[model samples]
Target: MAANNGLRYKDKVTIVTGGSKGIGLGVVQVFVKNGAKVVFCARREAEGKEVEADLNKLGIGEALFIPCDVSKEEEIKNLIEKTVAKYGRIDCLVNNAGYHPPHMPIDDFSSDDFRELLNVNLVSYFIAAKYALPYLRKVEGNIINMSSLVGQIGQFGAVTYVATKGGISAMTRALSIDEAKYNVRVNSVSPGNVWTPMWNSGAQATPNPEKTIENGANSQLIGRYGTLEESGTACLFLAADATFCTGIDLNLSGGAELNYGIKTMRGEKELPF
Candidate 1:
C-alpha cells in the first residue's frame, strides 16, 4: 500500500486530548492523515466543532470531536467511553490536553490558582491515561504525554507551571516501568519554543508583543520558532514507529535546551527565524 494509502496507522484508533487547536490539533492531523481513526476533545465546543468539520473532510480516516473538560473526571471518562464505543479499540493515547496559566510570582499565587494549574496541566494527563489504560493494554498500545522544556529546566516566574511539567516528565518514566509487564510503552514529548496559540497569547500579554515574539525566536539556537507540524510529527513517531522506545522524553525543541558555555555562545545575534 502507498504510504498515504492507509498504511501507517490504517484503521488504528487513537485519542488526542485538547485537539481543537495548537499542538494537539497538529497531532490529530498527523494521525488522521496517516489513516488512524482519531477521537479528539476540546473544552470549547465551538472550536471543537470547527476542527471536527475540517478533519471529517479527510477521506482516509475519521476524526471525532467530543467537547470535553479533561480537568473533570466525569468528562474524561466520557471521552474515553465514547471513543471506545465508536472505534471498539484504542491503539494510541496522546495526553496532549493541558493549560499554562500566566506567570505568577511565588508569593502572589492564591490557593485556588495553584490547584487549578495542577489540575489542568498535570492531573488531566493522569486521569486520561488511567481511563485509557485498560483499552491500551488490550492492544499493547503506547501513551505520549506532552511535556515542555520548562519542565526539565525550570522557568522563572512560572513556578507552578514548571512544577507540573517536571511532574509530567517524571511520570512518563515511572509509568513506562509500571506498564512494561503489559507490553505498553509510555513516553513524553518535551517541546521547546513552538509558535502556537499559547506562545502567541503570551506575546499578546507582553507590553511589546512584536518585540517579545522576536526575543522568543532569537532565544532558540535555531533562530526561529518550531512549527506545530514538527511537534505533531514527533508525537506520531512516538506512537507509531518507536516500538522499542519507552520511558524516554523526546525533546522536540531545535536544540533550545542545550547548554553552551559563554565562549561558545553566538558572538552576535542574527535575525530570528
Candidate 2:
C-alpha cells in the first residue's frame, strides 16, 4: 500500500468556537483553505453573518456560523449539535473563544471578573468537549484548546485571565489522558501575541497604535508579534497532522516563552539608579 496522506485534513468536518473573529477566525480560514468543511460560532450575529458571507465568497468548502455563547452548557451543546447536523461528523474541534477584561491588580479584581474569565476561558473548553466527544470519538477526532503565554508566566495585571490560562494548561494534560482510550486527541496552542481584530480594536483606542504594535512585537525574541495566518498554521498542524500528539501544548509565542523578563522593559536600557 502507498504511504498514508497524513498531513491533510481534507474533507474533515471541523468546528471552531468563537470563530466570528480573531484567532478563531484565523483557524477557520486555514481549515477552509485546506479543504475542510468548517462551522464556526460566536455570540455576535452580525459579525458571524458577515464572516459567513466572506467565507462563502471564497468558494472554499462550505462554511457555517452559528450564534453561540460557549460559556453556557446549553449553548455549547447546541453549537456542536448544529455543526454535526450540518456536517455529519466532527473530525476536529478548535476551542478558540476567549475574553480578556481590563487589567487590574489582584486585590482590586472583582469576583465577577474572575468568574467570567473562568467561564469563558476554562469552562467553555470542557463544555465543548463534553458535547463533541461522542462524534469525535467515532472518528478519532482531535481537540485544540486555545491558551496563552500569560497563563504559563502570569501577566502582571491580568490575574483572572492568567488563572484561566493556567487552568487550561492543567486541564489539557488531564483531559488528554482521559480521552486517550477513546481515541480522541486533546491538545492546546498557547499564542504569545497575534495581530488580529482583537488586537487592532484595542490599539485603536490607545494613544499610539503603531507604538503599541511595536512594543508588542519587540516583546518576542523573534522581534515581532504573530499574525493570524501564522497562528492558523499551527492550529492546522495540531488539528490534523499530529497523530501521536496529545496532552501537549504547542507554544506559538514567537520565542517569548524563552525570554520571560525581557518584554517588560519595553526595549529600554536600565538606568543605574
Candidate 3:
C-alpha cells in the first residue's frame, strides 16, 4: 500500500487516553491531522479542555476531551460509553495513559505501591481494551498499547514501572491471538527516551538537568531525544498502515538497543573508512 495521505483517516473515530499532554497529545494531534475524530481523556479537566480547543482550531478533524482518571473502573467504563454514545462507533483505541514515579529501589516500594502503579499503567489498558473490543470487533479496528523499551530490557531502580510495561506487552500479544477471530488487531509501541513533559520534569528534578538531558540524548544512537511528532507518526503508521502487524511490540528506540558499547559523539571523530 502507499503511505497514508493527510486525510487517510477521514471520519474514522479514535479514542486516546492521557491525551491532554505528552505522547498522548502527540497521538491525538496526528490522528486529528489525518482526519480522525478523536475523543481523548485526561485527569486534568483544564488541560484536557485546552487541548480540545487547540486541536479543534485546526479544522481538519474533530476532538473531544473528557476528564477521566483511568485508575477508576467506573471512569473508564463511562469514558467508553460516552465515546460510543457520541460517535456511534469506534475504529481504534490507544491505551496510552500511564504513571511513572521517581526512580526508587525495590526495597523502597511496598507491594501496595506496586499494585497501585499497575492499576494506572497496566490494568487500565486491559479495562479499556475489554470495553472497546465489542465496538472494535464490529469495525475490525485495532488497539495500540504504549509500552517502554525498559519493559524489554531492564532499568535499575524502576522495578515497578518495568513490571507494568512488560505485562502490557505480554497482554497485548495474548489479546491479539484471541481477538484475531474477531478481526480485532492488538499491538504495542515500545518507546525509548521520548522527549515529553515527563522527561523534562524528570530531568529538571536532577542536580544537573542540562547534563542529564544531554546524557539521555547521547544514549541513543541517533544522538537526540525522539520528538512528539515522531512518536505520533509511529502510532499513526501502526494504526493505519501496518495492516499485517499484530501482537508485535514495535521498538521506537532510535537504535538504542542495537549494540553494547560506548556511543560516539557526532562530528567528534573521522569515520574508519
Score each candidate by Cα lDDT.
0.87, 0.84, 0.91
lDDT of 1 at 102: 68
Identify the candidate with maximal TM-score. Answer: 3
**TM per candidate:** 0.93, 0.90, 0.93
Q: Model 3 reaches what TM-score against the true structure?
A: 0.93
List model 1 lDDT by residue over 122-239, tens digit each. Answer: 9999999999999999999999999999998777568888989999999999999999999999999998888889889988887678998997787678889988788888988888
Encode model 2's per-residue lDDT on 1-273: one tens digit a residue.
223243256788999998888889888888888778888999999999898898889865768889998888898888888887777899999999998765456888889979977998899998898889899999999999999988887776678898899888889899999999988999999999888777777666566778777877877889977887788899999887788899999999988878446344455443111
lDDT of 3 by residue, 178-259 (tens): 9999888999999989999999998887777898889889778999999888988999999988999999999999988878
RMSD (Cα, Å) of model 3: 5.6
Best by lDDT: 3
Residue pairs with backbone atoms closer than 3 Å in model 1 (clashes): 223-273
**Residue 256: error of model 1 in Å?**
0.7
